[model samples]
Structures are given as C-alpha cells and as structure tokens.
Target chain A: MDRKNIKGFLEFVYDFYKSMKAHEITLVYEGEITHQITKAFTSLTESNMAKEEESNSVQKKVFHVMVECLQNISKHADSFGSDDFLFAGRGIFMVSRGDLEYHVTTGNVIENSKIEELSKILDHINSLDKEGLKQLYKTQMREGRLSEKGGAGLGFIDIARKTGRKLEYHFLPIDEDTHFFVLTSTISRNE
Target chain B: METIKIMGTDDTPTVILDAQNEIFEISGRSLPEDVTAFYDPILQWLDEYSSSPNPKTIFTFKLVYFNTASSKLLLDILMKLEQLHEAGNNVVVHWYYPEDDEDMQEAGEEYADIVDVPFEQIGYTLS
Candidate 1:
C-alpha cells in the first residue's frame, strides 16, 4: 500500500526508542491533540526519576514552566468546541532521551499562514542567550497585556531560557489549511 | 473596605487584601479556573482602598508563579497603588522573590517601572 513509508517511519521510531534506556515510558497518544497536552507533561514528570530528587526550588520552577508551556500550546493550536479553551491540540507529544538529558517534543497543527510569524518568534527567542532572554522576559512581563488568556507571547521564550537549550522546531505542511508545528527542547540536569 | 483572605491553593495564591489596613498581599501560584471570580473581590477592595486613602499602604507580592490573566490583574492592582501614591498617600511595594528566580525578580522590576511608588526587590534565602 501507499502507506508503506508511514509504516516504515513508525517501525524506525519503534526501533530507535527500543534501543534507548529511558527511565520512564508513556503510552503513545493519538487523535485530538488537545487532550494530550497534559499527557505530554505527565510523561515527562513520570520518566524523569531525577525529578523527584530535584530540589524543591527546581521542582517549583519546572512545575510552573510545565503549566505555562502546556497552556501555550492550548492557546496557539487550532481546535473546535466550547471546551477548546480548556484543551489544545491537533498535535503529537513524546519524550525521548540522549546521553545526559531528557527531551520533550510537542507537535501541534497550525494555520499555514502563521508560519512566518511563528518562525520569526522562534528565531528571535533563539537568538537571545540567557541574559537577553531575561531582559526580554522582564520587558514583556511588565508591558504585556493581562486581560488576554495567553502570556505576552513570552511563555515559549521563557521555556527556552529556563531549559537552557536551543528550541528545535519543524514545520511539516499537513494540507492547505493547516501545518504541523513541532517544538523539541531538552532539559539538562547535568552541568 | 473589607478583609478578604483566600488561602493559597494548588492552582491559586493566597490573596490578602485588607482595605482597612491597606495591606495587599498575593503569594503562591495563580492559575485559577475562573480568574475573574478570584480577582473580582480583590479588585473591588482596591477600589475602596483608593477612595479613602490610608496613611501607609504596603503591597507585597510573593508569587511563585502566575498566568497571563493574573499578570494583567497584577498590573491593574499596581496601577491603582500608583494612583494612591500620586494622590499623596504613603504607598510602598515590598516585592519578594526567590533568589535564583530571575523571572519573578524581573516581574517585580517591571512593576516598579510603571508604578510611582517605591518598589524594593527582596530576595529570600531559599529554604
């Protein structure tokens, strides 16, 4: 069937993950992406046993960041229904690993028209190192609007800064109306 | 002028805004299901506090985390305090944040810029 490539892709992914030594594993989720937002976060927390040993300070910060990031996806993603405000998706979320870090990846469906804006924001945030992110975070937090449901578009930037990792992204065109946006970030516990 | 004390929840912060005492404190996390309900009374109390100026008003915000809506309401609250200060009332914001947390500290600094009151950033030793 013409689905061979998709099947192959799945096989490769399976083999790749089977080779890794992940401390925690989460059930793969499919279908409407919004419901998976919380699942993605839970997966991260579940997999990272080190998370428990983490200092209360780190735990609090990570918890805060997790909530903010999940909300961000919900705010930006395309969805249908009154409960849409409470959930997000049309995306995929998974956690994988490297040698010394855990990776969190979330993919969501977005309007193709907004790709340029999203790219610009990602590039701008990526360009800023720690200090620059701090300055930007402060600037946005102070002057940013509060009445809105989303942060001053600073949530993702804040995430990149806090994680101390470059945000990795991919845009796969799903169709004329929508595009799949992927965001991959790593949180490093080893310094 | 009323006293409202809502203890901090897993999702929201403790809100202690006493109109009579002129002590406004919001501490802990803030990501309430319905932010309007949680903030409505606090906003109303601030209105009263502004009307009959207290000799000294201390606004303390020690939030571990707050979402966007809470952030806006925070600005509204700060602006009210600024008006109080402008009206020749003694208003001071003693903002405290965890020492290593640049986000919270910067948030305090941002508020300091917009409001005319004296804003101090106090870093507590991590406990």
Candidate 2:
C-alpha cells in the first residue's frame, strides 16, 4: 500500500477504535465500497438471540433503521465523476453492536453549501419528540419546499422518532467546497 | 390521472393507490433504495386524486415496517387526505399495526393528532 493510503487507513482505524471503545462487533465500509448490507444486517440481528427468540418487532425496527442508514451512502455515492477531488465523496457506512444498544453511523462527502441546510434539518428533527415529530413532519409535508427531485426532508426525523433515540451528527470539514457529513443514531434493545 | 401500483417486497411495501377508485393502500415493509423516486408517483396520484371530489377515500396503511423516508411520504399522503377532508370530502384512514406493536400504534396516534380526519388504528395478531 502507498504511504498516503496506509496512513489514511491507520488513521481511520484508530479513530473508529477510539470512538467505539466498548463495541465487540464493528463493521466498517469505507470508500467506493459495496456489499449486501442486508446480510450483515440480518446476521447482527440474529446474534441478538443468545438462546431465546426475540420478537419480530425488534427485528423489523433494526432492519428498517439499518437499511435506511445504508441507503444514504448508496444515494450519495458520486460514481463516474472525472474530478479525482470528488473521489473523497465515496462515504463510509458503519454499524457497531454493544451489549445493550446498537450504533449506526454513516459518513459521506457533500457539497459545502448543503451543510447549512442539512444542519437545519437535523436540528429541526432533533428538536421534536415523537408527538412533536409527527406534527412537524405533517406541517413540513404541507408547506415545506419540495425539490424538483421531490425530497421534503423528513428522513432524519423519522429515524429519530422510530428508533426512540436522539439523532446525533457531525460535519467535518474536508476542503473548500465539501464537508464530510456524519450521522449517528442509537437504538436501545433494553427498551 | 391513472392508478400507481408497486409490488411488495421483503424489504419494501406494496404501494397500491388507484386514483379512479379513491382507494389508497400501503402494506408490508418499506426500505426502497431511493425514497424520493419510490414515493413520488404515490404522492402525485394522491395529489391528482384530491383535485376531483371522490365520494369515499379510504387510506389503508398496514405497513409492517418503513424507514425514515417512507415516514415522510406517509405524512404527505395523510396531509393530502386532510386537505381533501377539509374541503368536505369523505376521507377515512385505517392504520393497521400488528397486535402488541405499541410503536406502530403510537405512530398512528401521532398521525391522528396532526391530521383532521379520524385515524382508526386496528391491530391483528400475527399468529
């Protein structure tokens, strides 16, 4: 491996290990990578059963959340771009399993101009609880700006409400015109 | 102007909305690759359906599962129905959840609180 690539890899591993101090099972997908996320999703879910069978509700919610988070990576992947600088937009999707909760995090490079809008949406969704989320979601649907692409921006809020957890996020500056968007959410199995 | 039908899958729901019949049904799970594309037609169909007065509009949403994006579209559908109801059309939303799934039941109630129409949450045992 080239020195630069090796350095980046080591740094990523170090950061991931530091962040997930207590997780036993950690799956990390980096760069322009692809996999059957569903298989990993199903296996991690099945591992939850030590011997006793768990409810289908738990399985469904976990699966739903996993797929939703992974789809963000697929949706934002910039493939076939001529600019090598745009190569960093490849993204990373990671899932970490702890004894009591599951942590799902995804990071993708996005346009710097979109950072404000993304932050606003995250802040708005985080500001609401289940009831408030539903209300705000409805209101947005009624009056929010719909892109010609047809997105009204309620995906993050739904994640928060459905998982019954806070939607955590961070924006790490990558360059002049782009930033790495990292979103993390937790689902408690004990609940 | 026409009905939109999307077959169900293990990961996604079956979107069955017929503008002509004024019967909208979303069943099964929802985790489509692209949320916007998957839901646009359904939203468009509902929008067109709302323009003309349909005597009875029944929205049956029995989603075993749905991701965050699908939740957004679900709200969109409900709001469109609310607009229709406000205009004095007959609109009712039947929200079905698996028995013992309090999360789904709570989700329905939350939607009920937002929209004007009555949302009846029905539960059926999987067994």
Candidate 3:
C-alpha cells in the first residue's frame, strides 16, 4: 500500500469518527433490513437507552419509531438492479442523541412510481394535528385493509402521533425509476 | 376448547387464553415482524371461544409497548371480544400499563372508544 494514500485514508477515518462523536451517534447499521435485524437493533437500542438512564417514555418513543422505520424499509425497499437482488431490502438506520432529544433516521431505496403515493400519505399526515392524527390512525385501523406486507398504513401516522411533529423526509432521485427515501423523527429526552 | 398459552419473547408478548382455569391475559412488549401470523391463531381462538364462551369473560391486555402492525391486530382482538359482549356474554377488558407509561393507557382508551365494551384501565409501577 502507498504510504501517502494510507495517510489520506486515515485522516478521512479520523474526521468521520470525530463527526460521529460530535453527534453522539450511538448505533448505526447499513445492510439488508430483515426482520431479524429489526429485532436485534431494537433490543440493542433498548438496553443502551436504559444504560443512559433515559426516561421510560423517551426510550419507548425512540424504540417505537425505530421499529416502524426499520420495518418500513424491509417492507417497502426495492432492488436497484438484478445483480444486486440482496439490495432489494437494504437500508441505513442511525440513532443520534443530542441535548434533550434523540433522533432516529433511516434511508432506503424506493421505486419512483411509489413516491407519489407515499408522499401523499406523508403530506396528509403532516397537515394533521395530534387529535387529527389520532383520528386518522383509528380510522385507518378500523377501515383500511392491511397490505400484503401486513401493514395497515399506520406506520407513518403512528410515528407522527408519537413524535408530535411533522415527519422530516427527502427523496433524492437515483435513476429514472428509483429514488432514495430518508426519514427522520425526533423525540424529546423527557416527557 | 384447549387453552392457548404462548410464552413471551423479546419481540412478542406472553399470551394466556385459558378458560377452564379462568385466566386470560396477554402481557409484555409486542413488535412481532409477521404480526398477522402471530395474531391469526389468537383471533381464531377468540373465534372458537365465541361459540361457547363462558358466561362471564375478563380479558386483560398488559402490553407495555406494541408497534403499529400489532396495534391493528389489537383492534381485531377487541372487536372479537365485543362480539362476545354483543352475544349476551358479560365481558370486561382490563387494560394494564406501567404507571409511568401513559401512552399505553391512551392506547387502551382509543380502543375503548372504537369498540363498545367495558374497559377498565389499571396502572402498576414498573418492576
């Protein structure tokens, strides 16, 4: 290995580590978001949060959103190419702790055609207050049919209701038929 | 009717639906990946129990946390119990939560609002 190239790579690694420490990124994973992965991640976060002496409500809120986001990726992520079929269910999940708050962010590949419907659901959720979100949640549960993936379309709404804020998201174009979707939800450290 | 007793795990709740022994409750956290598969048998058992349900039935939900997927199935469970109540069986749903976890109580209240059954909210300190 070239000494100069190795030095440059080490510098980059050092910068990344510092950035992660600055943000208090406690957990991060980037790979196929399978059911087993979701279980393990949430369990790990639960104990970690407990170790930090976080309040019960804050831990639950973060835990709940993490599950929804992780499962959201597993249920909805799509493959980028035939050669990378495993990437079909791949995504990135991270948890960062800041003063008085914690944030859970997830990113996954989604079909461009599916963007409109998903955005509509998110936008509708954004327009609602806590009471309205609760109504939407109950109505969806009572009347909406579960998708083949076994979701009653309650993930986004539930997250919104729990967080009591609009979902922060972005859809970056990747190709003519696919885009990368990122979602972040914030929870206060104290109730 | 045979009782259904499934032990809890890290991701699923402990379910005990015993009629002969007069103990019926589901407790613990729930975020099962295939929520339908986990709940199908419980719904089906409630269906069977509906046919010859005891005269007085008390179903307790001691869930600490559940995901949106499990939330949907929860309504199905409550609806099943409502059916039993409608069929002239006296039914009461005892909803338990950690004293500090009011969200679980609110969850129970939402289900109570949606379904027409007597629901009693009980809170216990976390152990």
Pairs in steric clash, model 2: B12-B29
**Winning model by DockQ:** 3
Worst 10 residues of 3 chain B by lDDT: B97-106
CA RMSD of all predictions: 5.2, 5.2, 1.6
| Candidate 2 C-alpha lDDT tens digits along B61-115 | 9987776556666787888889999999988899999898887887798788877
Residues A69-169 of candidate 3 have per-residue lDDT tens digits of 99888888888766645467788999999888999999999998889998999999999998999899999999988899877789999899888878999
Please report, in order, the local distance difference test score of every candidate based on alpha carbons. 0.70, 0.72, 0.90
Report chain A TM-scores, every model. 0.70, 0.71, 0.92
| C-alpha lDDT of candidate 3 relative to the true structure | 0.90
Which residue pairs overlap in candidate 3's backbone?
Answer: none
Model 2 local distance difference test score: 0.72
Candidate 2 residue lDDT tens string, A1-191: 79999999999999878876655546777765333555455556557543335456555566666766666565554433356644632678777767677777888878877778878878877777777987776676556664543344555666786688878888888777777788887877665
TM for every model, in the order presented, reads: 0.77, 0.72, 0.95
Q: Model 3: runs farther than 4 Å from truth?
A: A1-5, A83-86
lDDT tens digits, residues B1-127, model 3?
A: 8989999998899999999987889999888878899999999999999999887899999998899999999999999999899888999999998888878989989999999999999989976
Clashes of each: 4, 1, 0
lDDT of 2 at A190: 69
DockQ of 1: 0.35
